[model samples]
Target: MRRKYNPYALPPWLKKSRDVLHQFAIPFCIFQGIRTILFPTAFDVLFLIALVLITVALKIELL
Candidate 1:
């Protein structure tokens, strides 16, 4: 007998977080990609600073 595929076996929290991350990752990565191609050096520097600010905000929010 073949084993049945299971889609809902994942924990709800894990699934939710994964969905949120996936949503954020798409646009975030797209913008970063476009920024890199259109404005490599300047965008890279600004991206780094923005990333730092985002990390700090996340840390603060989590804490």
Candidate 2:
């Protein structure tokens, strides 16, 4: 059986960092999206996709 996830079990420092990343995810995604639009490189497109996925995961508490 799989164990239940417990956010409270995370260390204080890790929790703080997670909070910080959670807060920044959206802006980072937006910036990356704009950068991708301007440049349209393969790497930029891939990176923007990854950023969007990460932002979604963070919002849904899956990360």
Model 2 residue pairs with clashes: none
Best by TM-score: 2
Local accuracy of candidate 2 as per-residue lDDT tens digits, 1-63: 999988899999989999999999999989988888888999998998898898898899987
Model 2 residue 27 lDDT?
96
Give a tens-digit lDDT track for model 1, residues 7-60. 377688876875675446446756776777787797586885675555555445
Least well predicted 10-residue stretch by lDDT in candidate 2: 54-63
Task: For each candidate, give its TM-score against the true structure.
Answer: 0.44, 0.92
Which candidate gets the maximum lDDT versus the true structure?
2
How far residue 12's Cα lies from its native spot in candidate 1, in Å, is 1.1
lDDT of 2 at 45: 89
Give the whole-model CA lDDT for all candidates, comma-separated.
0.62, 0.90
Q: Which ten residues in a row have the lowest lDDT in candidate 1?
A: 54-63
User: Model 1 reaches what TM-score against the true structure?
Assistant: 0.44
